[model samples]
Target: MMIKELEKLFVRDLEKLRGELDQYPNEETLWKVVDGISNSGGNLVMHLCGNLQHFIGAVLHDTGYVRQRDFEFNGRMDLNQLNEEIGKTIEVIRSYFKDADSETFDGDYPLEVFGYPMSIGYFLIHLQGHLNYHLGQINYHRRILS
Candidate 1:
């Protein structure tokens, strides 16, 4: 039940991010940083994708995925490629959640993201919140930039 809820939120936010990307008027707009913004919507999406792939894919499933944290912000990708990557991230997230069970959720997280020992379930919630926080940023970026 907990996994189900987490999966729902993950998939939903990923899809929402994808949809928001599509709503951007152009690739340039997706990459534009507003005057006061530190990162563009494109950078936020890339960061989110790299983050999940690292924590959930490589760390949890041993998928051998490597995260380039710096490139996630500095990189430039066309909107089509960005959407394709988001699709891959969504698949990875779904695969992990589907295989996870109560014991898995109760197990220790592979890394101490919050500087303390925490359960996988707790970290998953934190990840989801992180995703949503950026999703909101992307939405506002699009609204203002478009």
Candidate 2:
């Protein structure tokens, strides 16, 4: 039940991320570095995609996703490309958890992501919250640019 609820939240937040990507006036705008903020919105999008795809898709579902964590923060993607990655992320999250059972949620996450192992459910919840936090930053960046 927790995974299902988290699934809904993940999808909801990702949809909101898509909207944020849509709101950007241009690709260059999404990558602009504000005076104080070093992170570009485009970079954040890539980071989110790489992070979720690797953690949830690869780790949990054996989806064979390989994350390039540095590229996520350093690379740039056009709006359409970001949307594509987001779409893939959404699909990965949806299908992985669609048939998840208690064992899936209760099981220990394979990696020691935060210095120690945690339940899959706890990791998923952490990831969902992370998404929302970045989503807000993207929204704020868009507003600042506008």
Candidate 3:
């Protein structure tokens, strides 16, 4: 039940992330850096995608995803590629979650991501929060730059 809810929110926000990227005027502006804003909307989408792919997709389910953390922030993708990546991220989440049971949430997470063990359920919620935080940043970035 918990995993289902989390998965829904994750997919919803990821779709929104894709929409945000598509809404950008162009690929260049998606990666634009102004005086006040450091990270562009494109970079934020990439970061969120990688973050989820690594944590939920790879870590929890062993999807064999290799996450390049730095490139997530530095990399540039055109709107089409960005949309595809986010779509892939969404499928990754849904793939594991479709078979996930309540027990999947109660166990300890495979990694001590913050230097201490945390429950899978707790860590999942944390990941969701992280996703939304960046999603908001991307939305604000789009507004400010536009």
Per-residue lDDT of model 1, residues 110-139, tens digit only: 789879999998888989999999999999
- The residue pairs in collision within model 2 are none
Q: lDDT per residue, candidate 3, 23-46, as tens digits?
A: 777778888888888888888888
- Ranking according to TM-score, highest score first: 1, 2, 3
- Pairwise TM-score winner, candidates 1 and 2: 1
> Largest lDDT belongs to which candidate?
1
The best candidate by TM-score is: 1
Q: Which 10-residue span in candidate 1 carries the lowest summed lDDT? A: 1-10
Model 1 residue 4 CA deviation in Å: 1.1
Q: Which TM-score value belongs to model 3?
A: 0.94
lDDT per model vs. reference: 0.91, 0.90, 0.86
Per-candidate RMSD, Å = 0.9, 1.0, 1.2
As for candidate 3, its clashing pairs are none
> For every model shown, what is its TM-score relative to the native structure?
0.97, 0.96, 0.94
